[model samples]
Target: MSATLRSIAMGDGTAPVDMLAALFEARGWPCSADSAEEISGEIQGSWATYQVRCVWRAEDRVLQLLCLPDIRIAKEKRAPATELLALINEQMWLGHFDIWSDGGMLLYRHGAMLGDDGLLTLSQAQALVEAAIEECDRFYPAFQFVLWSDKSAREALDSALIDAAGEA
Candidate 1:
């Protein structure tokens, strides 16, 4: 099946956090302080490097990823943020997931495993990594990859926030 891609630019006066919360709630995903705090930590940590943030969600066993770019920075730098977001957008377009954005609100994207085909399969994960690497090469160029996974719901929520940033 072909992937679905949707893009919405946040005009202004939108809070990424509030936008993300509403999106997740609208989709019936679980939202809690623990999850929010964890995602906040991840976003804070990533701010020094990439100017985007992202989040991941798994509801009723379906996985969804959200990305939010730092628009101000992206508009200023242009290439790095745009290229990185495009790569992720490509992943969504390939039937890899769902994507959208709200006014200055966090950009949002999601992926759910409707079947084995919809999941980010091993190959898809590899592709995601490669895409990220390519973007890093053009931007940071000296960045390194580190594998980390949180098997808790916190991980899912945090991922959603980071993904919303559209950094990786």
Candidate 2:
């Protein structure tokens, strides 16, 4: 940890906004934190551009990141979207994809516990953001396949994973 992070982690009464800014700075990722609760920015992925939002809850010692794309499921395709989310989430070990059925909004969400006794350190915050972005980018194409094509959830996910591996 850097000296600044060490000081912040030592509970120097730093604001969550400052801590978040520092965290992203340490990781060298650009962000905007004009609000106290969250930071919002665009993360460029291999296949897509995601609008990433990082929310902090200091009272609860928790952080959440939501990666949202332009993908939206039609009303008739809600069931398939739900099925895709289930299939995708099963293979995921950290974050999970979710659908807002009524609004047809799709998002990849990850939550991390900062633990009650400790400060939300720079490393923990960076890890949470990294995992959320990685999972979101990796699975974005599968969600697109399910929404735009007639592929089944299993097929879409399998194809997406194969493509992701090829990229790696």
What TM-score would each prediction reach against the true structure?
0.27, 0.80
The clash count for each model shown is: 31, 0
Residue lDDT tens for model 2, 1-168 = 667766777763345556777776665667899588888877677677778887878778677778887678888888877898898889889888888666788888887766665356555666776787788778888888887887898888888888333533
lDDT of each: 0.32, 0.76
lDDT of 1 at 11: 28
Model 1 per-residue lDDT tens digits across residues 70-127? 3232233333334444544554433221223223222333343435332333333334
- Residue 72 lDDT, candidate 1, scale 0-100: 34
- Screening candidate 2 with a backbone cut-off below 3 angstroms (N, C-alpha, C), the clashing residue pairs are none
Each model's Cα RMSD: 17.1, 3.3
Question: Measured by TM-score, how close is model 1 to the native structure?
Answer: 0.27
